[model samples]
Target chain A: MKSGTWRISGRETSSLPLFNTEVMGVAARRTRGRRFWSNLVNGPAARYLFILPTILFILIFLGYPLVQSIYISFTDASLLRPDVNHVGLKNYAQLLSDRLFWLSLRHSFQLTFTAVALQAILGLGLAVLLNQKVPGIQIFRNIALVTWVIPIAATVVLFSFAATPEYGLFNVLLKQIGLGDLQRYWFGNRDTAMWMIILMHVWRNAPFYALALLAAMQAIPQTLYEAAQVDGANAWTRFWVITFPYIRYTLGVMIVLHVIFTFNNFEFVFLSTGGGPVRATEVLPTYIFEQSWQYYRLGYAAAIGVAMMLILLTITLISVRLMERARRS
Target chain B: MTMRKIGYYSAVYILLILSFAFLLVPIIWVFLASLTEPRQITSGSLWPGLRSLTLDSYRRTLGSADVRIHLRNSFVIASMTTIATLLIATLAAYSTSRFARISGASITVVVLSQMFPYVLLMIPFYQLALQFNALDSYASIVFTHVVVALPFSFWMLKSYFDNVPRDLDEAALIDGCNYISLLYRVILPCAAPGLVVVAFFAFVSSWGEYMFASILSQSKQTATITVLLQGYISGRRIEWGLVSASTILSIAPTVILFALTQRWLVAGLMSGAVKE
Candidate 1:
């Protein structure tokens, strides 16, 4: 209490014992309102008060929206049309039959799988390299993380520096390398558009994996590696026998984190490609956003949104199970 | 052995350099391109000479009232989100840390909620906004941004509180400081660094959000800077320099915040996630 400088107000009551029955008695004699507040703040009720705001925020903000989403998905709701009729899974039925919907769903998973796989592989490689006892590696590690720091919107704009047609950076570089004919309008070509989206995803996320995995690698006991080296284990053998086991948990967690992230990712595809080049890069989130906003098909968008929820739920469960299995071993 | 070690390190150094270049080329170009004259980017001179660099594009981009409104919108939303997330998440985190009754269900809900497909939440949130006539209002956008930041902020702050030695809390209680006083006086001050990181995380997430902003705040009145940049971010033959300048401006706040808070942010985030 002597060193407590936080007593900025220094009220007389602040110095008093928190649950003073005498103060409660004085408050009880003075007014019921005073007793309530003191009990509210200073008494056991403060525990509920501490939790009240979060519960209220979650219930009103998250719970309500969720309930409204499932409800609206069953209705024929459109912003353009006034009436919202209960259509009973008509939107989902249409979605299942719709070729474009399936295509976008497939694209979503394809993009997620490809990007996650590539990022993990590339990330592990980068992590191994970065873990070496080389000078200036810290600077390189920081530079690598710069990609993760730039937000999604800015990342799109940065990639557009190379994505713009004839005058873009990649095209210009191509010309210098005598591959001017191979210069591509990346987001415009169907084959390249999806790849461009993947490229951007990898460019932005791989370093995060590297950072996490490197931290995991660094956490491993150095004596284990030293012991292996003394037993004539080579670099490859040491990494396989020692390094891989330790970093797997961090790697698994990072992969799941990014998987959910990339799956629900709307900004990257929507901003970069707008699901264009004939919808080659169209993923579930972008598809739903387009349906809701551009087409004003609210009910249909909600159905797709619900489908997205289901897929994400499954991925999360499977990842959890995998993590548990790994932990047990 | 020495020669093999040197050879191995040389390869590692080369790969590291290439990786850095791959990651940084666009970032370096954005900085350089934001300085070039608007005409140079469109005319195929993507890399302008250092002597020709100018801030003309940045000057012109900032002069627009539309951009100013969008920037203000982002600032208002992000600020509200930071303050709200800090207050709500910290309180909940403290309660959960001290009381085990709420921790089990709360942690489960919070973690599951993160995987709830943001797009799934988008339309319902949109309808909720329209239903309450909160469309284009700062309250509507700020509410949604808080939701986005809540899970992570809650986790981060909870872990920070968890790590706070219980001895401090007991000492405060013995000194007659109630839970509220103990939290405000001892726990919060100890977790102040975590609060800073969560606040910055909330600010950055809300600033960069686009889908919710586009839906809930359709009009320019409440559209965030991210939405504003979307209009100029296309591949049209427009002045790339202007777009670059606006982007740099929009991202400046987050970049500055990240630079200031990177150490605590990275360490806290790693520990927070792994604890799950």
Candidate 2:
């Protein structure tokens, strides 16, 4: 039935008359006042009409704000006073000299690399595991995605509960496993704070990569693996030679995406540690937040924001090129 | 060889189980904590016996006027943002998918827009809001949330639209249907699953959003559930019971929606990744 309808529709396009004004009565055409108006409304101009709303919206909300943010970075602006004056490179210079700014930058890089690396590796492992013809694997995959589905705020709350020092679930588990000494204040301790946030991030995001890679892995022909096995390739060799190559493009895309997301992630760090324990977890986003809202240094924060944008812009361009290459190949 | 195969299978099963446990334990722990007494949660027992479990925390949290307000605000903002985003994104996706000239520029804009960090936009948005006297208003937050959800939604929906057969458009055109009516009558209905995916993306993005919600909606009147949840964490005297219950409540909608739509969601994500 579906195929019959599809065939009919296929023929209709090839056989249908162009601009069949006969379908509309002469009276209706007279009421509508000339074919020019109808043609204009229904022609190429109509395509622009469809997209104009979105373009206008982006211009107002995204494009304008971006330009404004860059402009604000160069001026001496603060929440305290409505007036603004051009300050040249003062904000950028201040950001360069600011110890906290440098620290936050370092933290952003550390968090992005560590979290993305962990997520990629673990996600690939999970994808490989789930790709096996194991019974009930789909259930496990769905369960793994629960963290990704839940709100970051909720995840932060749960992790904070687990990380509580004295009686947290993490400590209790460690003690139960006779690794009691390994347990410490996860969020409160400076040494472990950033790592805990990274752990939380990986836990929430790895499933995304896992699911995406799993889909890609499923698309790979089974004959490739069979051929590798016939060639006497071991399990490790089979993975490295066949599986890894098949998913590398996807892996690259996910890595770039993860970098962008982790670098800009605000709520996970904000809600969990609030970039606390003496700024040990202060990433760029939270730093910008504090500088702008807490200290009312709007211009300085905008400068930092601009720096973050420029870095991400470069990564985005590279990602676009990679995606294009992947698409072609 | 059979023995080695058995060993390999067992190891894989064990690792899979362990990973599942790692992901599930925190959620299960939070669920248990939400049901336990406040003192018991602080005491941090691995489990609260069935007898110790009570609904008082959920009751108290839900009974609070502040939580109610925040919940309402979150619903309003997220729903509005989803509607606005879908409206704009659907049109844009349709235009790009059908038109040659617009496709290249539109796709690039959509992809590039994702890299603009929301933090940068927040500074200027705040200033704009202040100038327009739009702070603490639904319009301010909803507008920003729409922008936040737009880029990805547009891309995903465009991919969905691409899957739709263009032959149907020609068929409708022959029936005297114009572009607008054709999109309304033919393309959108056929792309229902894609629309669902886009709507879910927009809804969830705005639902869980915190940064813009916190910054824009400062007053309690406009605060979202996420903002209220942050208050629970940042407060000097933490109420673990209330926090757990509220956290569960805050996420329940999204979790339920996700569970119901996991298949479509995963498929959408896969196509978006591979196709792009």
Candidate 3:
């Protein structure tokens, strides 16, 4: 109570200066009068005018839709119906019971793991290769990012076309190479569809990761390597002790972003398989489409949407925290 | 020891060569098939048989009733989106960096919006677009694309602008230059490299976008090249020749654009993670 009373006294004392300045200080009043209206009309107002459009766009397009999806998660809504029937947790309950949902969830995890793991490993390996100042190496580096440049939808269609069992270029090449018997259906069957999609995803994304990591790697100084070499360290030792540690944080961030991108991707899978021959390759995005658009069960799809958001949120938080902590140290 | 080094070099070369071939094969196959007559694909002869080469698929895909209109629509939408996004993002990022601080909540919202699965936005955005009476209009496509592409451009340009020395602005102010003239004459020219990267990325993204274009547009007048490509390939009886032809054509402009601006792309893409 004493401290509170003292703070009130301090504020009252500070306010007395303004009143005295207003009454007795003509110079101060003139300066304040000149700046006040202009500041009000120009400075703060202009700043807000600059900021408002972007904020409004984000809110209406991104924010509103996210909330709507959450609302839909609670009710029994479908694409065919205009009105949603409130069913509370029933849709989520149904999602838990649905076998296809579980399977797609598993497939989504599988896709993310395989794609990210291979992309990271191969990307790092390739980055290391190109980091050497080999002759004509710049051309190879130029070609490396081409896969990333290709559209995902185009890549999917091309790969799907290339993997066709009968007239596929892959099958033809295999047959010519004496593996005719093993030329199986790449996207026509359940067993191989997801695997093929995973391969395509890796092929498309690995170079992108390599480029990102390569850039990170180049930022490391040559002095460290020279010092290591002077200390009689071999290539392997120098790499492990220097290069690996240097790019580790960047790699972690890239991996998390890759995970999120791969997890949310729709065009590649949708174009290649449309979640079937038998719903074998359906990840969460395609699964949501199947539920909401195909089967017209919007609420159940929204539940899946919520689950996806939670999973992605957990992954992102963990990744950012882990990498950021390491960065600070 | 010298022999071992040569062998290692050869092995590496072989691996790289094989990987390059693997990467280019599908793309080459598409090109070859585009030249092959539709009948020959079913005949199962490879290499276009050296005798099956024709421009029938290209003629068909490009000369279709709706192809030209769709291409025009795509060009208009993507071009508009690119120009508008660049303007808004450049201004917004400059203001956010220089004039005022964007709150944590705003940052969070931006990040979350970017992370949002396009699938989740499909229905709601569509509903909103229709309610606003923007359905099947170029404005709808352009606006939706601008929203999607703004964050990237803003973030890219902001990071680049932040690295710029503020002394330039202060010096301009001392010289009695206003903010507008300073930005145009000084800041923008200094940020040319970043602007190129932002513009290229925005254009490429808007060019290649499929999901929104597919959902939001139904008629040829508003449909994009990707949607048109889908139309050619949707039936059970896939028109492999025509589909391949159109796909190749669709990518041609972008491929050329990237090839020309590869230096800037590498610099920009690398800059996000690479701070040298």
Candidate 4:
């Protein structure tokens, strides 16, 4: 109580300049300004200020470019020309009839489905195998994950080297096994070109799925499995009843993420095949790039990009809806 | 055990072995090919004989000035991008973590970000760089990469920050700690492991990126390692030995980071994906 009274006395004495109004005017205003500034600095306003940089970054770098891209889709803006001519839906109309565009759209679906499906299946299998109480099981899982960590460029080059025409690893192995008939330019052949793209994607993404599903599998109670076995449920029955249901959400999450990734993925396809063997492996990403960068059809490429974005948006919504339904059911 | 039981165990082991080989052989082959002679590589032979193995590719690749410049550019750009991403993402994540209204708003942005492919963003970036006279500049590449890496980084960091207890944040604030100090002194140290994982993530993505670098990095001064590899492959004859050696160099940082932080990274991935 004595310290409090002393602090009050100190404040009252310090305010004696108030009686000498001329001397206190500037100092009083400065203190008022400082208090306001400190109030902002020490309040909830400061917390919201933290995201100001992020918001400004998005608005300037990402959002502005996106808005410009959408606008360019409606204009005949080519890098070859200095002026951007306003063309009303001409680019979009052209995309409707463009053969390569449709082929690419079709191939995009093909790759996304084939790769996602294969990854889900392969991942489930590997997760199940590794989930078994085998000694050194972690070694298998860890090595598999290495495929996912390496860069896309490295993976492409590694596979490309392995698939070299004459005596590459795949062909050489074929020769050693007395099946030289299978030896050919795997990527050059139209039939196998798309598969090669899918192979690289699956090789990279499947382990990710496996890891997710395995984590989910580990969270299930061991006693639940024991109870199921006591009830005469076999291994397959127990898995379908317990393991499958438990990991379904993780599987769903992975599927949604991977679908977006595979559909928009350019590096793997671009590096591995360059949409080669006469457009057999051409997808929307490479097609968009070729039209814009190679042909300088900036306006046209923007239109295609707009279209691709809508397709991705639609697919994402549908999958998310389906995932929600799966969770409910 | 019955014969059927023995068969089941044997089959499981066989499948495991085959799957592991499929996944691991390519990574192992990169190291082997890096040591093999260029001529042996040209013959489509993965095995260059035990005696033919040498450090010749490493010596040549390291000796090349071109490789050195690219390695430097790649490291600098990736490091810059990582630092920038962590700074922006951490502050945004921490602030947004404190408020429901703002985080809800930012989550929409993050999800919506998934819609814009790099190809869509490519033209504007090209033109923007040119307009700003930042073309062929490290700042341009680093800026583009930071933007690219931001959304995922923000999401991951936000999740990690959420995992940090809020009681501590309140206690610090109650003890006369300012908002910024609370984040730096309290929250960040708690989330240090997550920070390392996110750093590895940001670095790896920047190191691997190609499309923008291919266009923006037009000169020797700014080309990243991926661009260097692209140049080697686009030529008539790819020097496999050089490419392999370059690949080793490109992935070396990630290999070391992963070797040290594999456990932390795995946990981060699991928690990020499966949490909700």
Best by lDDT: 2
> Please, what are the lDDT tens digits per residue for candidate 1 over residues B41-91?
655664688777998988888888988999999999989999999999998
Error of 2 at A314 (Å): 2.7
Q: Candidate 1: lDDT of A176?
A: 79
Identify the superior model by lDDT, candidate 3 or candidate 4: 4
Between candidates 1 and 3, which one is better according to lDDT? 1
Clash pairs for candidate 4: none
lDDT of each residue in A140-160, candidate 1, tens digit only: 765566677667888898887
Interface RMSD (Å) of candidate 2: 2.9
DockQ of 1: 0.48
Candidate 2 segments exceeding 4 Å error: A1-30, A33-41, A318-329, B1-5
Candidates 1 and 4 compared: the better one by lDDT is 4
Candidate 1, which segments miss by more than 4 Å at Cα? A1-32, B1-5, B43-46
lDDT of 3 by residue, B181-204 (tens): 566787888888888888877787
Give all TM-scores, in the order shown: 0.92, 0.92, 0.89, 0.92
Fraction of native A-B contacts kept, per candidate: 0.59, 0.65, 0.34, 0.50
Summing lDDT over every window of 10 consecutive residues in candidate 4 chain A, give the lowest-scoring window.
Answer: A3-12
Model 3 score (lDDT): 0.78
lDDT of 2 by residue, A20-95 (tens): 4554436337745667666555655777787888889899988887788788899998989989999999999998
